[model samples]
Target chain A: MEKFRANLMLCAGTGCVASGSAKVHAALRDEIKKRGLEDELKIVLTGCNGYCAEGPVMAVYPDEIFYQKLTVEDVPTLVEEHFLKGRPYQKLMFKEPEKKTAIPLMKDIPFFKHQVLRVLRNKGLIDPEKIEEYIARDGYLAAAKALTEMTSEDIIKVIKDSGVRGRGGAGFPTGMKWEFASKVKSDIKFMLCNGDEGDPGAFMDRSVMEADPHSVIEGMIIGAKAIGAHHGFIYVRAEYPLAVQRLQLAIDQATEAGLLGKNILDTGFDFVLEIYLGAGAFVCGEETALMRSIEGKRGMPRPRPPFPAVKGLWDKPSVLNNVETLAQISPIILNGAGWYRSLGTEKSAGTKVFALTGAISNVGLVEVPMGIPLRTIIYDIGGGPKKGRTFKAVQLGGPSGGCIPESLLDIPVTYEDIQATGAIVGSGGMVVMDDNTCMVGTAKFFLEFTADESCGKCVPCRVGTKILLDILTDITEGKGKESDIETLEDLARDILASSLCGLGQTAPNPILTTIKYFRDEYESHIVHKWCKAGVCRDLTTFWIDEKMCKACGACLRACPSKAIVGEKKVPHKIIQELCVNCRTCYDTCKFNSIRILPAGFEGDPYEFLGIGAAAATTGEKKGDA
Target chain B: MPRLTIEDLKKIKEKHRADFTLREGGYRAKVTVHMGTCGIAAGARNVMTALMDEITKANLTDVIITTSGCAGLCAREPLATVEIMDQPPVKYCDLNDDKMRVIFKEHIMGGTPVEKYGLVVGSETTY
Candidate 1:
């Protein structure tokens, strides 16, 4: 970057690609060539820039000026003004949403300001396709050090001291996992890197594999040496074709550079890496299930005790770690364990990458330190939901993890702390829910996903989830009774206790947590047959309150069902049978005049408010500290 | 390529270290052209040609030039940020051939920024 006057880093990751980064790239190349400034200016296509919403993103090196939401048409003028004149592109910098004023530098933006980039160190900085760019950033230097200077014993101890746990949902200590495999006396033990990121809202693993393929390669080679294994495979989801493609390219580059394959680094340690793609099964994320899939068997979780560390990947002593956990290896090995320990809390050391999305202003990936509070992530980092709507809860761990209510936002993010709040940091997918989201509806959605993806290896997950979903569907559709609540709680506990594998064991999390926190919402559904957010269409009805109605005629115009009957500047009445429970009028009414009433409301609709407006007081009682 | 040794790895790192030297006596001057679509639309290519022609005409080997993606301020698309060693980066905005030529001759070569075209002096960008 310093050798060249400046470098144009164009984001080539998936988000930017969807937003037309390829056109931007071609336009840039053509523009640079036409100017004959090819030698003077270097154009490098980098990976995910993290600021995904306003992509295709680009940043000028040396000066570190940030630009986003670029299109092909903006190329010629950009090349002219920026390259010819030494000036700041004030219009292209990240604009503050409220002020609509551009923030020129990357560090000033709230999205990148809070993140401590260790795993994502190469994000938006280096061209992932070029091994040379990675090398220049000291990519495989850590692996070289481990092979030549440090012993296998030293590698394990440094990782142990660093306290980096498995980032693939389960927070098992990495050092301990490595130590177990290293001690095992086997001729052909394997180092398996799990890239099967199946969580619905999670994409951190995908970003890492796409952005820093060499880092994963370097980590695997080092892990292989430490565990006394010469053969390994990175089990990535078949759905992640780009990740698989990038890893293949990186493997070729590393092999060519003598960093992988007969990796002498002049040392006799010979380690080779390969890729095995799973058929996009969620259960394949489980270590044993992934191994079985690699072995050409059905991807389903088996019982533990003979955990993958003891017997894994073709019945050989092996070590399996997540893509993110492996990326952390090179940094820990290069910077030492103490440096890694400095960033996070005592228990949860190092940073966690989260795919922050759903009802949030900043829709992208964020890697924050483990000790940061949820309130900071939601408020400071995420900009506190989409403006006016209040923050309800954030679904932390997909179907396998539970939701954390607003009251517990003060709790620091750690494996133990998150678990205490009925959610595990399961691969860091923080889906922020708003006031409009129905608690029972949200729970049912996650349940439906697990029920669909349940490998069906055991009865608890296969049958238990089915039954729980049926009850939730009944509750939402106004066919439920009070007895169903206690019945669901009992059934969820039974499934947790008797389920054979992790899938079955964790299937009841969404239902259990929703009932635990939002009991009043569930109670409202059963007793009054009401849905507060109008999400449960069957139990809900819409009516315009005559007192508050400004007679704006907004509801009549906006109604998709055309059920509302009214004249200009007059209060409207919803024709009941034609209403179709659409709630279009409710959303369209600006005067807050339209309200939801239960379908069988015996009296005035004004008196019968939904559960969200009712006394729903079942979450954490303490104020955020 | 031959197998890499510890010495070879060190040499590679050293080369990179020198190439990416960021601070103090690191380099004489470095200029970045914002080339993201936003900049391109704002005529960054013309800026590149103008800057390149001037650099060649001046026969200046000390000054380095490069291109970057969008600086995000698409409104003032044509942008150039200059970094001189031991000094904060200066962003000169809405650059065209004439304004850039003057900046290159006076600010880049003579160490005096053209006040009118310079959007913000120093990289704090606090506002």
Candidate 2:
């Protein structure tokens, strides 16, 4: 075969394709033909380039020139200048934000500089659909090493020395899990990939599978060889249609290449992989529950001691690892345990990918080495909070995780460091919050989600989550009692102690963390019956700020309750008695005239609701008022 | 077909005689277009098309083009980076059809990278 002189790699990942990468490909081919240089320059559409915020990205090989945000019209200039004359357009380069200078190479961007790509090393570099591109990059080299060079024991020892843990929540050591599965004396053994990532606003696994499906496949093959498992399953949520499709295609490609199926790398070890679609149940993320679903049963957690390592799917020894965790296997094997271990902190080796969303400037996927400060991710990588909003809190680990206040912003992110603050490094879902967010409302939302997703198998999770949601809901609605706070703490402890699985055990995290950090917000709700952020509709009453009200009938027209009563261009009076506190007038008032005051204040909703001193109050002495 | 053992894969790599230099000339031009969701939403598709069409129309096979995902400057969409051999690469923001044509003609094929539209200006080695 003739060697191609130059290679042009395009990010054909979903994000880029949706942004018109296909058209870019068409133009490149057309231009190459028009210039009669098609043979010299080879253009290949590859997988995702992790920095999704600046996508439609491409990299030129040998030189490694990185460019961002190109268009159709630029094709002619590209053909005229760079293609024929050997000159690149400086105007289309990537600009360094702080230095305000243009960066020519892909590696120079700070987003790429700080990251030590292990799982994502081949993502943006290879064509996911074509097996040859993957092979060209030494993709299946690790499985080759494991099958031909190392025994099952040797493979396990190498993994053990790597210090890698499950990227899925819980941080269980990967090699130890494999060792236990391998030791179990069972005829049937299974390897499962926990792709049922139900955490809200988290898509790290999806990105990996989409960009590098073969990595996960290669990882699983190695795991099966080590654990003596012949059958494997990738339990992906039904919601991720694209990931499922890509995974299936990858399986077919690997089979064709003899990388999977009967004789993988001619090692005499036979294995087959199947895809199981999860019906959007959050509990299935738990190990036992996930196993049950893979076995075509209702997804629910079962008792431990007879753990999955001993009796898993169909009462066989089984090992389960999340997509991100499995994706790390091949790289560790190929590069050596020490190379993988050298990047991250001592406890957590290798980089972690996070789906940074909500109130952040750069809201997309970020893969950073462990122990990097939260401040760097939030400010430097994420570009700080959106709209110049002051950073308030970052809710890590989803509903099963806790909120870390700004005071903890400087804390280095790792499994143990985050756990020190009572939050787990769950699937890397980091939701940024601003001061405008009401803590009580935020806690209530998480409780509602946990309550709804509970499997109802255990009494503590089913009943306790419901109770927690009710109390949090009451607090957000301004009916909270001081005793309610104590009751919440007590119930959280009870659930933690008695719940059947990790799901229930960590269900109370959001509420407990909010109470720990923002106890004052809860106090104001119980004693003062006021929502400081004015987000809780029931606790607020809208009144016209007489000085600010222009009464152009705008508020009157906008008010669903007809709470504003005044003529045009004149000062409007908000009828306190008629107001339902829906705040329609407040939302409609362009003049910013509407105001909400605490319960006992002159403009308070308590007077309008007619509760007036008859309402129950907790914490304060009865005669204090 | 026999089952491939780990040793077979190793032998294949050891005995591999394929050419390592698939592409020739260190003077090839590179263009990177940011196609993250936000960039796409801001009409990066058109910008990518313009660049490719111009390169094709000019019969410039040495010019390579590709797309990547978000660079975090969401406020500016349709971002592109251009690099010519032996020259600095530059990032351009808010690209449109007209600007793309000028960039393709004057920068990518003409040996001169447009400076005014550049968001970042530096050598490719630093990144």
Best candidate per DockQ, number? 1
Q: TM-score each candidate.
A: 0.86, 0.76
Q: Could you give the interface RMSD of each candidate, to one decimal?
A: 7.0, 10.9
lDDT accuracy of residue B60 in candidate 2: 51
Model 2 TM-score?
0.76
For A1-625, candidate 2 gives per-residue lDDT tens digits of 1233346777777778778788988997898899776754668777777655666777766446776776677777765555443445565667865566778876676666666677786776666776555655577888888888889899999899999999998899999999999998888899999999999988889888888898999999999999999999999999888789889998987887688888776778888998999998999999999998877899999999798999998989999999999999997888788988887899988788888888877777888889899899888888888753588899999999999999998999999999988777899999998866888898888888999999999999999999999998888776788899999999999999999998899999998899899999899788877775667876665566666677688888887777777897779987777877776776677776666665434533333334336335333232210
For model 1, chain A alone compared with the true chain A gives a TM-score of 0.95
Chain A TM-scores in order: 0.95, 0.86
Encode model 1's per-residue lDDT on A1-625: one tens digit a residue: 1234567888999899999999999999999889766765678787887778789999876566788888888888777767644466677788887899878877788888999999999898777997777887887889988998889999999999999999998899999999999988887899999999988888999999999999898898889888888989999988888888999999887887788788457688898889998889888888899999999999877787787777898989989989999998998999999999998999999999999988888889999999999998988888888866788889998888898899999999999999988888989888999988999999999999889988887887798899999999999988898899999999999999998777778878888888889999999888878787888888787777776878888888888878989886677898888988887887788887877766555453433343234234544332111
Number of backbone-clashing residue pairs for each candidate, in the order shown:
51, 108
What are the per-model DockQ values? 0.23, 0.10
